[model samples]
Target chain A: DAGVTQSPTHLIKTRGQQVTLRCSPKSGHDTVSWYQQALGQGPQFIFQYYEEEERQRGNFPDRFSGHQFPNYSSELNVNALLLGDSALYLCASSFGVIRLGQFFGPGTRLTVL
Target chain B: AQTVTQSQPEMSVQEAETVTLSCTYDTSESDYYLFWYKQPPSRQMILVIRQEAYKQQNATENRFSVNFQKAAKSFSLKISDSQLGDAAMYFCAYRRRNAGGTSYGKLTFGQGTILTVHP
Candidate 1:
């Protein structure tokens, strides 16, 4: 079975620029969560999507937003990016909202120059 | 709000030895789940093991096991018979068991511990 997949192996952006990352959940999964992992640190929750709507969010700024598509794929958008926004972006998927296990994808490495 | 902490930033062990990574969490909710994830240089986060809060018995999987102290809010991962493949950055994560109404599955993660295995 296919696992979670993310687009753009790596990305580079300057300060105040906008960037978007995409993620496709596992073939049989529907829920998708996004995380941001800074260098030498663990992944921080960004937001989660299900049923083509945002289910919950973390303590992130308004500039950070996300969307869930009808196909169970998701996208994370960041506006007015700061240098600190550079990190590895991970997408996790599960079969249901209350599922116990979450499978993660190969994260997209973001570098803010 | 839930917070997970990993005090050890770096640790090393012999290939055949064992090592433990410490993790502590604070949460008011009684129903929740704890997880240990391994992220190698490839950057793919893999679940090592998980423990349910209500389950008194500590969760174990193969050579990977957890010492879960519910009262102290402590969860540590012990990797026995460590191999070179076990060398990676380990993360401790927490998720609340939402009963209903937007039961989003978001994980609260610790800072992380880097494990280095030497031959």
Candidate 2:
């Protein structure tokens, strides 16, 4: 059973540019959640996706959005990137909407210049 | 606006010793869950332990155990016989219970505690 997997372990983009980070959940998982962790801070909730639909979102602005595919994989898209957006974006997967013990990916370290 | 807070920004413990990291949370809802996640330099969030709001008994896994105080809204984690592998950033998180176990989970996390295990 493969654990959660994220692509483009590191990303660099200029301000105003857009970036997309990807995640594949562990097998048998159906829900995916995205989080942003700034340096020296814990991961902050971004949004959660289940059954290809966004179920809940955090205080993040419209600049942060996400999608969950039928296979339960997910992508986090950040638009109009600001230097503040430079952080580690983590994707966590669970077996269901109420599942505990979410498994997180290694995360994509985004650096916005 | 539920919030979780970890008072300790950094902590160090000698190998084979015991250490406790403190955590406190503020929430209006009575039903919820608390979690402790460890992130090492690799940055993979690993579930260390979890406690349910309804359960009075603390949760334990291996050498890790939690001191959950529902009335105080406090959840502290204790690691016994700590090893070098225990050194990591420990985050305290909260998730309100969702209907039917939908797992529509959104965690409110504290500004994590950095644990250093000296051998």
Candidate 3:
């Protein structure tokens, strides 16, 4: 069975531009969560989606949003990207509960130039 | 607010040796979970081991184990018989245990510690 998969292994954008990163959850999983990992730092929670609706969010601003499809895949969209927005975007999927732990993807490296 | 802290920014050890990575967290909630995740150059976060705050027994996973001290709010991971493959960034994370079990699934992570294993 495949684990979580993310598209666009790398991305380059400019300030004020928008970028969308995609992710497909592992088979048999229904929830998807996104994280941002700045250079040399651990991953920070962005938001989580279950049943196609956002169930929880982090301290991020409105410029960062996400969507979850019926298939359980997810998209993280960052608008008005700043140089600080450049980071590794990770996608994780879990079962119904958080205790099950989360399985993460390889993550997409975003560089805002 | 919950916060996880990994004081060691980097550590080095020889293969076949044991190395312990330190982690400490602060949370007002009594019931929660602590985790150690390994992120290799591949950038995939791999679950090393996890400990539930309510459980007094330290969790053990093969060559990996955790020392979870509830009162001290400390959770440390020890890697035994370390291998070159163990060289990577290790992260400490905390997740609040919601009574509903469905809400607040987000994880708060600490700054990672880069581990270097020598042959």
TM-score, chain B, predicted structure 2:
0.98
lDDT per residue as tens, model 1, B57-98? 999999999999999999999999999999999999999988
Instruction: Find the candidate with the highest DockQ and give its number.
Output: 2
Tens digits of lDDT, candidate 1, A1-113: 88899998999999999999999998988889999999999899998887888888888999999988989999999999999999999999987545357899999999998
Alpha-carbon TM-score of each model against the true structure:
0.96, 0.98, 0.97
lDDT by residue for model 3 (A40-82), tens: 9888899999999999999899999999998989999999999
DockQ of all predictions against the true structure, Cα-based: 0.64, 0.78, 0.70
TM-score of chain A of 2: 0.96
| Among all candidates shown, the one with the greatest TM-score | 2
Q: In candidate 2, how many Å is residue A21 off?
A: 0.5
The true-versus-predicted C-alpha distance at residue A77 of model 3, in Å, is 0.8
What CAPRI grade goes to candidate 3? Answer: medium
| CA lDDT, every model vs. true structure | 0.91, 0.92, 0.92
In order of listing, the candidates' clash counts read 0, 6, 0
Model 3, B2-80: lDDT tens digits are 9999999999999999999999999999988888999999899998888888889999999999999899999999999
Model 2, B14-106: lDDT tens digits are 999999999999999989989999999999999888888889999999999999999999999999999999999999999998767567778
Winner on TM-score (1 vs 2): 2
* Cα distance off (Å), candidate 3, residue A97: 3.0
